[model samples]
Target: MNEILILSEDVANMVAAGEVVERPFNVVKELMENSADAGATRISVVVENGGVGMVRVTDNGRGILPDDLPAALQRFATSKIKNADDVYNVKTFGFRGEALAAISSVSDFSIRSCRKDYDGAEIRIKHGGTPSGVPAPAIEGTTVEVRSLFANVPARLKFFKSFSAEEREIAKFVRFFSVINPNIAIELSINGKNTYTATAGMDMTARAVQVTREKDLVYGESEYEGMKLSFVTSLATVQRYRKDMIIVGVNGRVVKDPSIVQAVVTAYHRMIPDGKFPACAVSLHVDPDKVDVNVHPAKTTVKLLDARDIFSFVHHNIKNRLDDAGHDQGVQMRTPDSTEHITSNSYSRPEPDTKYDHQFATQSYDIASEMEVVEYEHRSSAEIVHIPEQSGAESAVRVVGQLFNTVIVCEKDGEALFIDQHVAHERVLYEKFIREAAMTVPSVVMYEPLLINVGEDELAVAEDSKDVFDKFGYEIESFGGESLKVSRVPTDVLNRDIEAQVKGILADMLEERKDTSVDYRALVMSCKAAVKAGDKLEMHEMRRLVSDLFTTDNPYTCPHGRPIVFKQPEEFFLRKFGR
Candidate 1:
């Protein structure tokens, strides 16, 4: 009658299986990691029925040994680490041997491998953690096959999603890994068809082109403190995710550190439109140890030894590229009106602040006063501001002319502003959209409220914001079980499909929480509705955009750190024309 009884080996393994083999995707992750650790130049993954029925991973690596094949599939066994101390300096991708053992315990699993120096070997194991026979001769490299995942654990089987959903998740992981290790060739196939392939040892631009199918209009490259930083960014297309394809790496490993991503976002802030994510590939080559890769179990995250220094370094690198591309106001050369052409009356402003009651908002007075006194003069509401005296502040130059419904040209004092009219206007419109979004309160709709279904994890977030939504005039009733019914949505967004807008709002709010500190649902809604790059704008509208931009609270950048305006300075024109 002991309170705790010793469980059988089968029971112990089943428990472990629950942790490591949650789904077929988990099996694919483990096998892919093993193949990566084995130094595979090319790794190919094939999955069937979302990996519920079959998952196969083949690698052209050194492969496993005949003598070690049995031990490799045993519980708590690992070749990557010998003792506990080795955990600190561990570099291999697959350090936990629990992957194979746990996978074998819950599904039919087989491994075939051959080291370059030895003969091939093969082994098969079934659910309940037992090997059938000794290792036998096989082909070179490694091929792992897992079948009927979670068959022994029907409870886990219940968690299996639709095959297409699971397949997408697996495909996402494969693409992530492929992007991280561009030097390693990777091929991912769904069922029998190849879904994706990456060229081995391609440069960052090449890799991005191959993976994203988007052209790499790399602006430029530069070095900071002896470490080279390259900017592989697109001119027009932006990503459709919370984190736009801004992948940062040091010494060839992928990292998701906020500081690094923040720096890049900050650098581009105000250059792009609000709520739109730019596609960028920023690769930094520095000493490997500067980054500690042992921070996370999956190594998708990392710790930078000098996070601040790295942040500043990368921020400046991107900032300089933007400036050189005539993305900053100060150094650009063009007509102020032509660069940011608005209608004659579109750039209206408040009367000059002669009363000196600037105390209402003091912190940003210098910038505001400059705009009020200098920018508003000479330019109609449709015209852009041109400031020759303030060459240091690139933002002083505003758009003067919008040509061919595509390019914006701004000139002030001795500087000119030439910008991709679409991108610049997108930034302006996006900012306005964000402002409109923030001001709009949700309206209560009494007619059969729409129900928003969410998982348990998302329930808390929805609940916490319920009151906030109420303030915006939205009434949400809890469905008692695990869902929320929306009785109302914001009125301004009424033009959009109610269901689609609400769903988009919720998803965007959740993503904003992850991407930036501003998590208000209203703000997220605004960001998602903002105009995107490649959106066309008329000349007068572009001019109005420039005028409105100068009046914004954070016109220098967007909410997410992308620059909305680029300036051309007089010095550049003087240098080119020799005074």
Candidate 2:
């Protein structure tokens, strides 16, 4: 007998299932892709127990004929391509033809499809067995149902996450597809509870808003060298803590291209403050011949013929839009007594002023010196603070006086309380803005819209962030090549230099840093708008600040994690004076 023998078909299919059907999400993805390729206008996905118990997808598209039903479950059988040459130019989502075969080998699978020219047919395959096909009720589309996934493969079942976690993964993928395929009405149900539904006929922007839950997005379009790019991006002022909100699709297929994502982030460089990412939906259309979708088994990664050129193109276009929205780079603003203003070239000692005492000036000098003298070095992650919930005790605190015009002195229950003026004010303003943001804040329309001249790069950033400006009450529009017109301003900053404030907001949007929960735009605005160190406040203002600070949710720290209030016991005085 020969030493080597061909593997059994069932064993081979089971092996393929390891790659093609790694999880329930994969099954859903493949089925939905097939539906899309079939010209599905309406797709519905229903799952139970995170798809471990069941997964069903229905599509109203061109279905399979009874004659083709058996072949649809056979390995290497597909109508997507004829020969190896056609593989490079493949446009449909499913070309490998292994999805159904591999999926059926590990679970109970059935597909019911109806073609306009042929009688309806149904195919059933269980655990890699021979497929059984029969005539079924006449229908106009296809419905694929998978049950007891990984039932025959106990080892694979162990790798699955909890029901809720797995369901979240499925929901995430569905939302992504819904945004990219706006023309398709997508509905998802988990455990019979309708989770998500996007009605058909909505444009890409509208779909993005529905999926992302963000209303401050600006739409942009650009065509470059036979490629088209359509994107809806959040303003530098509107941001999320994580990069998960950024969605990118190539040729209508959602992908995980880090380079493309980085290009988009780079476009906002120096326009958004560091440690924040803008929420965006990017759709790229390229010639099928210029891209290869066979790079990964999952088909979620692709190879481009001119990746660098594409990256540059995306970067330029996105940057131009951001600039046209008045988010041009190179604008900086100063915060009173903030260490951010200290630089080696401009570092100098300040003369004492009557606004603050020597102690406050000394503290500011120390902070500035620490910032200026320290050499550049990477810092570790920030320390997490555990804040207890608020209670009635906070309301009893009373303001005493100001210390060095920086710290507010207060008295409560025989304890001396000291609050950092800047941090305290930041907390108050943060809460106030958050509350105002929940409502419809008023706006101030400019009598004459201000015209701003910008470079190509600036124009892109401005245009991309126009909607963001509008959301914040600044109505800005493109005024022809490299110029923007600002017709409205945020009521809060009407008295300030509108142009300078616009530039500052844009610059902050482009700056890069670590991820943070602090809204960089709001933080920057609050910091600028708040009363700073060395500003003398009347007794009533001090009392009002202390009163308002106590009313906030977290009175101890600002939005940026800086401590606001410090406490000292009366016993400390006894120890100091030896009473």
Candidate 3:
């Protein structure tokens, strides 16, 4: 082995820059966050050449003290925290203090600030050189300007996409940040052209409307155990094709937590199309210690300590609000041209950024390829008259005949039972699979790994819920961006439409079995593994299916909430025939 050696400060700073500054947009993010942390009420960001030429962030917050100007460029020097404990109780958007050090090491950087007690001062650094300070013009706040980002390290420039892509990222961040921090006025300019301005004093709803470019939003608020969640979402009438519209922020920091995203998708399960998403601006506020913001250097992803509880909180509150909106919409439709029902009350629609299956995730999949999309005909309450079978009664049920080779016809006393063969099998398989689930359930390892294309958002959910999927014997691994490779699957669900089953699992089937884990995998697996509509069954198979169906706790409905068994009494035939 060769002798180990320590890297120089310049080399180390560049290495840290690799993590802290990925692109020009990252430089803008760090500088903008600094302005916010400085208590700036009015902030402006100007970018040129997609922020590769120059990025200037100006703020009217409390300027950096003259004495701390030089120290601010030192690595690990930050006023946000003083001790190790402060890391857990951070209130500021930036605390690591590596941004400036890492940024200045590879770019032409300058910071100018003036406090009320002292005269205005400015600090400038050129590619990690010795910092120079001088008495600058008087100002009440701070201004950080970065030019030729990564100029010293041309290798970093190679990783960036075109200027348009970089500019889009910067614009996306500004729009999301403005929506979350409505109290601050933020201005953005690209290539010297004014993009947009978010004026101060606007509430979150108005700001969201202006930034999101959506209209007629609904507002909702809910608090549970000191945690608070408020949202401005589009009505059920409004929808978009992409999942990019669902912007979520926590404690003033915009993040992309999959748990939170799943909750939002679950809330709008059947309200939107199976392939569309809604536009929503969700703001969640909890104590600082409750969330881990240091998961990544960018701080765009967070790990919630109480993810399950938080999921419930987000889902129930938004679902309840949407339910009320739906109710109000009904009243509005009855009154011709009268628009005071929900529009006057509160919202905008939310479409997920990576909406793949009209559920959660980033990319789209042709769900109709593997499985037939069931189009249940719309029927009124009067048209859908049927009796629900009592869940658990030991009355004997006998298999009479098979209807259309689909439904298993049965008889118990004076009532005729029409049981959907597919759904009945699903119920039976779901209960059995759930009970046998363990750390690594029985699975079928395929010779060739099945590849599935999904959105980033959908992949995120899959990656996050790895444990849940493992119980159902799914071995999913990232096959690069927006694709997943499955080497193993649950034994019963083998050879079935794994793609459709994955979509259903990530889509509407995240119903929690109890207080702990979500059982979405079992529901989807059972549905996929069950017999098809035209799969003819023998008398013995039908009898065994009917016997196994009634033994389940919920024999009347399938795991997907569809009716499994329907009942018709002999009295109905007598009434219709005038007997």
- The clash count of every prediction, one per candidate, is 55, 38, 27
C-alpha positional error of residue 517 in candidate 3 after TM-score superposition, expressed in Å = 40
Q: Residue-wise lDDT of candidate 2 within 260-369, one digit each (tens)? A: 88888888788776766777888888988888988877777888888999999888888876665555672322222221211222322323322211221111123442
Against the reference, the lDDT scores of all candidates come to: 0.63, 0.75, 0.75
Task: Indicate whether candidate 1 or candidate 3 has the larger TM-score.
Answer: 3
Worst 10 residues of 1 by lDDT: 355-364
Write model 3 residue lDDT over 1-579, tens digit each, in one string: 769889999888889898988888888888888888888999999999989899999999998888888999988999999998888888888798899999999989999998877889998999988888878888799888998888889887888977866887898888888888888899999998887688986778877676655564667888899799988877655455566778999888888887887788777776766676767889999888888778898777888888899999999988777677653422211111112224432333334333122122122223442232122223221221222356633466666778888988877789988999999998988887666544333466666676876544456567766765665567787787457887767654544556656755665333332323335656665676678898888665676677778777788888778999889998987889999
* Per-prediction TM-score: 0.54, 0.59, 0.59
Give lDDT: candidate 2, residue 25. Answer: 94
**lDDT string, candidate 1, 1-579, tens digits:** 789999887787778777766666677777887887888888889999889989999999988878888898887798888987676555666465677887888888888889977877888888855586556465668998889888878888777877876886687667656766666888888888777788785655666655444442344466766566665654322322345467776545455677877887777676655565556666676545465656654445667777788889888877765555455642322222322221122222223423212223112123553454564354465554433223454445555665555556776557665655444433454455445544333243545566655433244557766755654555666786446787665544445555445545665666666655554564554454444444566454555555555565555566656665566677876888988
Of 1 and 3, the candidate ahead on lDDT is 3
